[model samples]
Target chain A: MLGEINLEKVGISCFFLSYLVAFAFEVTRLIKKSRTSRALMLLFAVAGLCAHTIFLLVRSRAADLPPLVGSQLDWMLVLAWLMVLFFLVYSLLDESSALGIFFLPLVLLIVGSTYFVGQEPRAVMEGQHSLKMAHAALLVFGISGVVIGFVIGLMYLVQHRRLKRKHGQAGGLSMPSLAKLARWNRLSVMLSFPLLTAGMLTGVGLGLYSQRTPEPVQLLDPVILSYGVVWLVMAVLFGWLLRAKPTAGKQVAWLTIWGSGFLLLTMIGLQVLNMDSWHS
Target chain B: MNLQVVYCTHHGTDLTLREKLAFSDEQTARAYDHLRNEFPDSEFVVLSTCNRVELYTAQESAKNVPTHQQLAEFFAEFHKVPREELFDDLLERTGPDAVRHLFSVAAGIDSMVVGEPQIVAQVREAYATARDHRASGPLANAMFERALKVGKRIRTETGLSEGRISIASVAVGDFGKSIFDRFDDKRVLVIGAGEMAEETLRYLHAEGVRDVVVTNRSIERAKMLAGQWGGTTAPFDQLDELLGQADIIVSTTGASRPIVSCERFQEVRRQGDPKEVFILDLGAPRDFDPAIGEVDDNVFLYCIDDLEATCDQNRKVRKKEIAAAQRIIDEETDEFMQAVYHRATGPIIRNLREKWNEISQLELERLFGKLPDLNQEDRDHLEQCFNRMVNKLLHPPLEVLREEAREGTPHGLMDALKRLFHLRD
Candidate 1:
């Protein structure tokens, strides 16, 4: 059925087309101020979001699992989904137009890479218990939080720089103030730390539980080692935030962005290389 | 009828010229009386603001309205300024352009802080005062009332007033209010009596801040500023004590080093309620260290750059409203021109109606006298029929005259109608 429909191609292309329409609509707001233009922009965004959701749902159905607990394609889709969800929620909260201007390109970059990258399904334990699913769910949620933290941190630094430079807010692009962005960055770190810990704990339980199987899980694959290293760095940032006397918000923003960004890259690279520890 | 405006506004003239040209209330009333004496046949309304000085005049003849040079002379004589000083600065617009200009100014489209609401009120006050002094007639009255409507339309239809577009306004309006609940309850400490500080203090006072303390390096200057604003002068040495007590600290001193360092402010914050304090450091060489902004969650310190950055963003948002405002101006220009043309043709219309009605009434009476055998009901129906015939006969020419008025005043057509119909002016 999936082969006959080419669901992946249709769904992805439809969402991209919607984004194209949305971008054009948003640009028109530069020339004229109208509530109609704003409404139309939001309309196109929701359309794109709906198409993106459908594509992921179809892919997950083909793989016979929830999208987050499926293949590498599903993992990247979850991240994109999280990012878009954040954009929609935040844009609605404040009539701020800056989020789409900054984050849409990143979304496009992630979505674009899905074309060239591997979409093959990972091998599940022959008789998979629900614990493995729980483990994947926890990890997916945790990674999504880290991605959010990274983006918000990037925003915080940009806002901090603009404020420090005294370069007034530019047209059509308004970031949250330094004070608000700092608060968001701080909250993201504090929240992501606990979620990430739960994710690691769940993964460890899955690894120990799967060890009794005929093909026992290995603990020291590059994916696991890299995950450990990334998690450790994030822990250090978390600890510093808790102890440090109010540091400059920009410095904290940059550190969080780079540190979390590094972890994300390594994790995605390990997946793209198909370096799962279960096979090792 | 013809209308014209000779003016110099915030855009065309500097503040110095505007101040010199401005009319105080008494002066404005006297100017209106003088204008009546000088140009007895014309209608006049003088609009004066901190940013602009405009005189709008309307008359039955373009020859009667004051010229740019004459209006300049009027300003010179009225304000005791030299004509040579202001003649080059003043500009004039006549007819439709004049109408459009007044509409734009009244709507705040020509404002220094575009979309500000004060200009509309100023326009209303000008018109009212002109009426009070019997300075405006039908044409000027129609123009001003329509302009007020146009101002209301622009505000309701556009997002021009959605954001704070100035550093002084946004800092005090957005972030400052978010930090403090009320300004009247707080003690405002102004450091370095510079222009930015003065401007910020003015906005603060406008927001109901009364208990202000001025501290500067120069004692005399501080005292002078404090005296002007009804605030007490704090000695320069007491900056630390004042810093701790001030709920709001606005620093625009041209200091070479950090006037309020993190260490200095942190000690100050300890003595005060640790809830919240708003500090606006507007100096170029950095009066307060940026590190001080990081001292606490409650201490929200914004420098000139930060506040200005928000203001720049607001300007972009405002730029989007320009098209909307222009559309309003265009619509209003059409409406006003139509009304003015109709007014120009009004007397002829009335004379034509009266002449035709008299002929119809006389013919109906003659017909009734010839046929007394007809019933009273039939005579009444015949009277209605003749009145309808007169109206039907007049409709086509009236329509053509209206069409011609749109292009212009229909001057040739109007003269022809008056002669052909034996209409009296």
Candidate 2:
């Protein structure tokens, strides 16, 4: 049976089904604190992650490029895949936690949105392959940080509300202490903003380098401008976080949600629109 | 065997009654001496705590076992309480019910704060005291040991005792720890030297608090409390300055009016650098004004009502684990009862076996003498065959006795076995 099964034929449906089952198991665990459910959830998550990894590798091989620069579809899948990696690791380490309930839906959103985005591979500018690769890698890692920041911020707000309302830790919705969440949230933004800034700076460098080549890229591209605007918003948030005294955790959580949520939305929305850009 | 417990706990009796009925160390020793004189064959153990006063007694014979009214009368006479006033509050349990009640108490399922852990140690200490005074016999030892084991099993197998349920602990652990990362570096200022304040300080001290300044209207009381925790006393008139200096404040005064109003706290905050302040107001009438919490983002104020709300939520969470805990208790109780019942059949079974064995030996010796020409191997084989026949004959009645013991003591079955086999107990 194993020899007869074809991995190349595995579609988004295969991994999507696995993740849905895993998420359902997470929900069941909350209702009935069962170690079996938690173990099964992890099993399904690992299976889905394997299939997802193979799918991305196959797509990258077919395109003759890395998945990060293959297409908007591949980029979104890679991002989703990274998040699944995070979720799986965290779930394995903390078996009783219900983080998958919060994380899996976002993964599904990104993976599902890949269908509407462009699938055709973009042309790699001559002698600019490495630079473009660096740009894409930086942006992916940076955005991954933002995604983590958003999730931690969400957890912080939840923990804050529970503490403020004087409700003990919710039965299955246990989270890190407010102090720990605040620290992690601060670290996420502090680290991600610099990487994002570097990624943007590299993109500008790529833009400048591409102008010297025969296929000169426009400096005033709408995609580039939109990215710059998003970067500025994050930079402002980053600055506020650094300068502000350790404020109330709820305020920090709200700022992180808005900042990271905007970045993710703009990045995915711009790519889906297929705006003319040197990278794509 | 007969076992019973007469008890008054927070569930059915008020603190005043429990206090009046409670036994101190000296009283417990004196009571045990009196009990030994009054009832020579009985075993007694008294468990007295702030929340409850329980007297457990076990006897080998039902004729000598203490009745509910008698135990109540003993309590009335011993504590000098009027019989009518104390009798109604004293509840009684016997036999299996008594065993189940002890298991529940040791496991903290019967506590006012369900799943509190102090009851386990309290039960253990009570048993130790009883043993030290030579008041506990073999039956009481077996029962109390099993109760302690059941308490440990419940704690490990269920999440009943996983969270803090006390008001002071809930305030410090659930809310205070959430605000600040470390307590050792924070300055702690206690506003009053009330019991609640000292309790809160105890919790904080366990969290590694070092810098503590206590201020109360009575300087001597403040000094006493501060000296207890290795802290220094501060003048009550310098409350605002101390408030500005401290990061965490615990106020538990008996004052009828709010001590720290919003305007006063706001002024104190303005004098200090903008930093986080965690305040626990444990007074009933509200030591700190409720408006102080809304005055600024830095002030994280929680009063007794807030802590009680958290405790209520924790109690509900603990309540969810009750069914699981009850299942464990039921299984343990049944096992213990079965053991006790099986022990009751021990003497009859032993006598019956010995009587049959003596008859087999006599008959075998006569047969060997008659069959002198038989080989040694054949003789040995014949003896084994006779032993198997005797075992097979005894199996049915003994099996029935063992089966009956599962439900109860099987005294009637033991008596019938004794009569049929002509065995003496």
Task: Give TM-scores for every candidate, taking all chains together and pairing residue i with residue i.
Answer: 0.72, 0.84
Writing each residue's lDDT as its tens digit, candidate 1 over B204-225 gives: 9988899999999997888887
**DockQ values per model:** 0.07, 0.34
* Candidate 1 residue B270 C-alpha distance from true site, Å: 17
Per-residue lDDT tens digits of candidate 1, residues A1-280? 6674765665677887777676677667655555676678788888899889888888787888777667776777777777788888877886745667656666776666666556777777765557766666667667777777788788776655553344544443456655566677788788877777777877787777778888767877677778878889889999988885443566678778987788778766676666546522
Chain B alone vs. reference chain B, TM-score for every model: 0.88, 0.89
Please report the TM-score between candidate 2 and the true structure. 0.84
Question: For this target, which candidate reaches the highest lDDT against the unseen true structure?
Answer: 2
Error of 1 at A274 (Å): 3.3
State each candidate's clash count.
3, 0
Q: Could you tell me the interface RMSD of model 2? A: 2.3
Q: Native contacts recovered, in order, as a fraction for each? A: 0.08, 0.37
- Fnat for model 2 comes to 0.37
Residues A1-280, candidate 2, lDDT per residue (tens digit)? 4632577788887888899999999888766566677878888988999889888888898899999889888888888899999888888787666678778988887887777788888877788788888888888989999998999899888766666666655445457666778888999999889889888888889888988898877878888888889899999999889887775567888999999999989988887777767644
